[model samples]
Target: MTFQSVFRWFGRRGQSTVHQVDQDGQKEFTFRAVALGLIIGCLLCFTNLYFGLQTGWISMMSLQSALIGYLMSKFLPTPITAQENIVLQTTAVATGTMPLAAGFVGILPALGLLEEDRDGTPPVHLSWIASVGWSCAVAFFGVFLSPPIRKQVIIEEQLAFPSGTATAQLISVLHELPPPDTTLRQRRGYTELDTEETLNDELSPVEPTELERLHEAAKPEPEGWSSLTWSFLASGIMTLGAYFFPVIFSVPLFGNYLAKQWLWTFTPSLSYIGQGIIMGFPTTLSMNLGMLVGWGILSPISKHAGWAPGPVGDMTSGARGWILWTSLAIMCSDSLVSLGPVISEIVYKKLLRRSISLEDEEDKEDKEVEPDDRLVPMKWVIWGLSGSVVFGTILVWMVFGNEGIKPWATLVGFVMGGLLSVLGVRALGETDLNPVSGLGKISQLLFAWIQPGNVVANIIAGGVAEAGAQQAGDLMQDLKTGHLIRASPRAQFYGQLIGSFLSIIVTTTAYTLYNRAYQIPGPSFPAPTAYVWLGLARLLRDGDLPEKSNVFMLAFGLFFGLVSAIKTYASQRQRWYAKWIPSGVAFAIGFLNTPSFSIARLIGGVVEYIYYRQVGKENGGIRLIIIASGFVLGEGVVSVISLILRTFGVGVASCWGCAHGMCGGCPS
Candidate 1:
């Protein structure tokens, strides 16, 4: 069947709904609308990249893009005048590209030891061709892998697709706004909603049931606009200020102190939760507590000091530590966790819930599924996994373990890393396994066994660790969006592929330039902690746990799991407590990472909460959300660009004169 016919079969391709009528009183999904959204998405992506390079907040891309997209729709005339179309496409691009970009730029160059041909050039480190080629290959694999996982996480587990939901919410609201009415009524002024209905009536078929459903669906839901607006703006101001004036403007208290005291901190402090919230005492306390757990309690005290907890460490060490290790564990564990839920959904629904769908289907046989169809066959998942492994192998081959490291050697590393990851996942399943500790142990072993310059070996090991952890967290979230929207696995896969491939190219070029301009540290920056892990492993081989090592992670994990179970149970009995508990946990996690991060989370949360409490409107809430999106995209791109610069010896911090300028004013 033709693409148009296929879409029509899905009930998605039809005349524009009454809520989507424009000034011309026309109604139908048009190419113009889709094109408009694509254009906005592209522009927002570029703007985000520009700002990310200029500043250091990597996560600002989503917020920035959303804000910009909303503003554009509000002010400019587009083929698709609805808010939902604009925001959804824009955020899809921004959110999907971030990690792919960051990982490509940071990991590829570091692994390849790619250096520029400058005066007294650092002996031809990594080849550009190899790095880029490897990136494309990896992109292809990630594109394929990310989608299936996303579906499993989203469709099966039914977790919140927070970011996607935020974007979709914005777009849906905008789509529903009544179009401007032109024809004057005989009795009075022109009517607004009637104009929209009149336009919609001409284009749509006479399906009474569908029309009723559409009308009911079009009704606006209550939203928290004012609170969201203030919080978004406040968070943006705090983040921007911290990025520009980190040292001088210290994020009020703890984040600054942590950055100052620590040798490496991931993500800056201004990006944390408690940055500038004088009124958010509960939020502040939660975040600070989280910081104490993540950094002081976890990073320093746990066995995984090999990888610093936050963004900076990930950047500094090429993520030789926990960042990678934990990510891999998360991925595998989540996949395992999601399996049960997904099977249940398919079986129970297929066997039982068929009557509801079957009766509907009887009226319409040969119906087509949309590209956004969330349900996926198991076959595609198997293909995705095979493809992921193949691409992962290729990634290790060309870019990372490039310095004459044997393929066999790298495979060994992968095996070791994978085994450790599995162990960590298993432990975390039943009990909390302080994943970093497991990562530290494995990294320590490799450090002792694999010499420096064995880039391929290290890269493979690193990939296993990182992917594992990231997959664990990401699988559920992506899957949640898939379940809600029913986005096709292929579409999701390709979307990620497009994102990853493009990001890799962007990352490589930007980082190369940044590294060249700055007289920063060489390709051989210290992996002090990584080596420390190596030493520890040797001691373990000789038989002895470090005197200061804490093995209480399992206990902690169990305790937290119990707490989570209790909260989940309580939430069923008292919905208010459920929301509050989750909010509190979120706040704590934010604080644990960086004060700035915590601050941003709190702002987003409060904005959402307050909007729900007052005015019962959605437009303002969506607009504010878009504003947050703008900031997120803007900062994320800038940071990605900055990383590229650093890779080339052009110190982004130095080039920008951050030591004395706004960037240097960080409290820590």
Candidate 2:
């Protein structure tokens, strides 16, 4: 059958003998696929952390994982199945954390940076109590917001989850059991190719493919309905209890609750931990600066000329307003620009294209299938909204009611946060569609609105804001994965909640140790580049533009936005771009990084291109790239684990310690 025919099979739910139509006949769940995904996931995560520690960009993992995953697919004993392949790859991609809220707070303290107590505690000596508090808060807020965000982005828009897409390919490759004809290679420039020899026999559920089955089974059912309830319940409990808790302990609790309150108020003041180590100053600066430039200058210019920058609001609220306007602009640009191709493709294939005449053999399946063409139902939206309100209430009470914010502000924040996610996905290319940053900006604006020294309002707003933005991108990606693979949105949301909750315990313990013992000095001190940028924006909003220097910042912001658009487009069109180069390069290069580092990345890219070009060669060029990429990723994550452990004053005799001893140097 032709490629178009195969896709038609995927879009349908239960036509084949199997409960689900494998996107390709080759696609199915299996142990091999899960193992492969797990191994790759670990490698990607480790490598990302290593590089994050070294170069400071989250997308680095995406580039390297794509290249390696592509290579690994080449050497499978059976022909690699495309669906499983995408799943695995996307999993690896999402596994790479960015500048999320808790990540920054936890990571910085672990590295012996950031004065934890706000008094005189050494930067390395952060409180475990505080770490736990923050982690729990992040998990609480992050998990709840995921489903609503998922609903708004993936369900509402039907946008492709870029990260999820990559992951689906990865998983699909692993699960496809009745291998295709491996010996064949494609002829050049052919629009279609012959299918590999049919499976010698009909395949059955086998033990080898159990992992994929388990993963599928593990997915949230009822479309995240239960998780939404849990979020609501959790928010209610936390909000009322905030008044009784200590300020430090309550900070995370309230902050997390408010994560969904207002999109702009969700970002926090101290959200530098994750990005600080993962991204260079230039990229981070530019992203933040874009918001400022758009808000502070672009919005005003438009307003002066009798035009509003999108539909968000007025842009004259200083730098804060500028950020809001820019955010709206970017979001609008991304959504409007991307929807056409995506919709056309879906409409053509799912509706018109599949109806083309088919042979009797293909018709056999169609004859047995249900004719319903409906997408996921609307019950999910109700579930998402109900959950958001519940969670937002809890967050508000915890932060605003207890710490210092008024109840009214908390309510406003929650509403704003959900709106942010809706707009974020509809506009910005934020696949995760989080509202924390927007909420935080809103809180900041509120501070200006309410006499400027409402520290409680500012603090609570900041916490929620950080969490919202922290989880925004990832949320979008997860939703996208759910959308494409026919995974339940509710299930994906629940899964995220489970992961985030567990992460609290894992990250809290790790972070506590990292803060107390393993402080590195000099070049190793992680820079709070994004924070600096935020501060600068804040200063500008305070009516003190840096005069001539502001021009450079604006230029950088424009450059960053353009590159982000290009990167987004490339990721959608070409699978290889995400696999090897990652979107990180554009951001990282904008900084004054050491020349050698850039050269090394360049060499890595060249090596990847060479491997990709020779996929059909005798030695199997693609396999070489995957194995090498695996090693690189493995080495990177491993090194970070070692260093973090060392920072905790753990014994150096372990394997990790040995690596650190060898590679350890003054931080750059």
Candidate 3:
């Protein structure tokens, strides 16, 4: 099929059997496929735990899983079909992200961190089994929530879920028909007589037979020397180098003094730049604006004014802690207010009973013919939502009965979760950014009022929204991948359901093992994301917060957040400068982290812009995306390896220089 035809398949839900059409009679939802996915997913689960605790973000390596699955499938009785491959990737992505959705590195660990922070406060630790139950209960509903979201976002509006789209395209390329006789590569430069072993040794490391040369030349690009592969390797090498020589790429935006005081350094993170390339320029720009405001503008002011009185970057008593509340306020206000348009439209449709038709009769017919078997049944949604809510409520009441989380409050959190899932899915679709952190903070803010002064209640409430948003975002993105590849939505749904259950055990086990080995929320793990959540939780409840200007900061943030969201909606409606409007979620993320992260992302955006401009927008864009995905995968996989190495005591050296004070002393 032509390239356009391949992408056109993204909108072709009516056919619904693209798997059969494309995969040479290969079946989907195969036993081996799922088994492979589970195996890989179980193994891949560790990477995210490493990433989340260190970077406070998770990068889904669906492409890496796809590539790895392809390589591994060769040893099986029969090579897995493309549909099966999608299942493998789906399962792996699902399993890998479970830590994120379940809050293993965030809310759960924050509980431990908070306990440690408080003197004489009894520690509240959930049994591992209870952790599994709560995590699964909170996350499984999103799997059920995926089908409708898929129909709306992936099929109807067709927002570019970048990671998903790239995954689909990669799977398509892998399963595409073999090259025609005397393929394009042969026409590019090579000939039957040419043997280049002497000239460029890497191109032909060993002398190959005529058939081998023909086969190599028939492929579009040699597998051994793919530009994307090299890009992946280069990124990984850079990451390793940075790990060893840490301070080199941590470039100070201001002088070393300010860089030490305010973390305004360009972090040595190619992973984030790859994230920026995927996120595109607009959201990254908003993140930079946030970094400037939170770190550049407010960080210094807060410290100098004594609004925050602890050491720098202290979540409990430092500027970082103080700024977190304002950040939460802005994100909560912005996200909640941003929902006005969506809510209004829903209400308008309900009240007026207006069914403004699809783009045309073709879409109308597509919708009408969209098979029930292909869609996630509403029964599943009802059952999943109800089942998960009941399970979660029971768990909450049983565990947190004394913590002031009544069953009714638990139900409210679930309801709030459902509402925030809409916002989360929207963000994921538009920017490939899941605002689950913001969603969690919003939950905390609401519950701070509902069950005042109850920190545990606030944390659990936030988890409800966090898990829901994370799963909602994850499943929708995974479904988007299946949608493009003509894999069965029903099959993908089953895969996610299975993965969710597995994640409950697999990811929980991984974290429990890691936490036992090395205490989390320590200097090494930090659990920065959880720190932010905990900081918000404490700020909302602590009496000392009133003594500082943090509340005033939060109030100011709320005001500005409302204005920003209002201006954003008004501008979009009035055909004003909507694109220029800074994203509240992105800004909040900036406040949550330091400048190094956002600056790295901004650089990635700039790099992507240059590529889009220099290389034409069509084929080059796709190529860049595929390569950029490699960049992300490379660094992430390397980081995971580095963590494992550290566990083994080989890669223990840290903080090569003392200029920025990330390391108390220079290791070198």
TM-score to native of every candidate shown: 0.53, 0.50, 0.76
For model 3, the superposed segments whose C-alpha errors exceed 4 Å read: 1-26, 31-47, 59-82, 115-121, 125-130, 148-229, 235-256, 354-386, 395-408, 422-435, 480-486, 513-519, 522-524, 542-577, 648-656, 664-668
For candidate 1, lDDT tens digit of each residue in 1-668? 87434334323322333233322444323333333334444544444333333221122233233334444333223323333333234334533444333333234333334223321123233455665655454344323344444433232222333343333333333344332111221211111112111101111112222333333432322223333344545645644544444442332243434444442233332223222221123334444455455545445533345434443334324222332222222222322332332234446645765454555445344323333333345576568656655665666566544453455554554445444443333222211111423353355346446644333344435544444443333322332333333333333343344444555555455445544543212212221222222323334334433232324323443444454455434432433343233222322233223333344545544554465357322223333333344344334334444344445544313123222212332211
The lDDT for every candidate, in the order shown, is 0.37, 0.38, 0.66
lDDT of 3 at 568: 44
After superposition, the stretches of candidate 2 with alpha carbons farther than 4 Å from their true spots are 1-55, 59-126, 140-156, 177-414, 426-463, 469-472, 488-491, 519-522, 537-548, 555-589, 592-597, 613-625, 644-668
TM-score of 3: 0.76
Please rank every candidate by TM-score, starting with the best: 3, 1, 2
**Residues 1-668, candidate 2, lDDT per residue (tens digit)?**
76434333333321232222242344433333333444555544444433444334444243234334444444444433444443444444434452244544323423343233431233333365555554454444444555555544444333433334444433333343232211212211111111110000001112224435433432332322233234334433432222122121112222332211211211111112222212222233433443334433554464454443343232233222333323333332333333333344445545764454555234334221111221223464466445655555564465224534565565555555554444444432322223333344554555556535343344444555445545655556545544544544433343344445544554445434433443322223232223322332344245454223345345544554565456445544443333222222233222322221333334343444444355421233223323334334434434444555556554422232111111123110
Clashing pairs in 3: none
Q: What is the lDDT of candidate 3?
A: 0.66
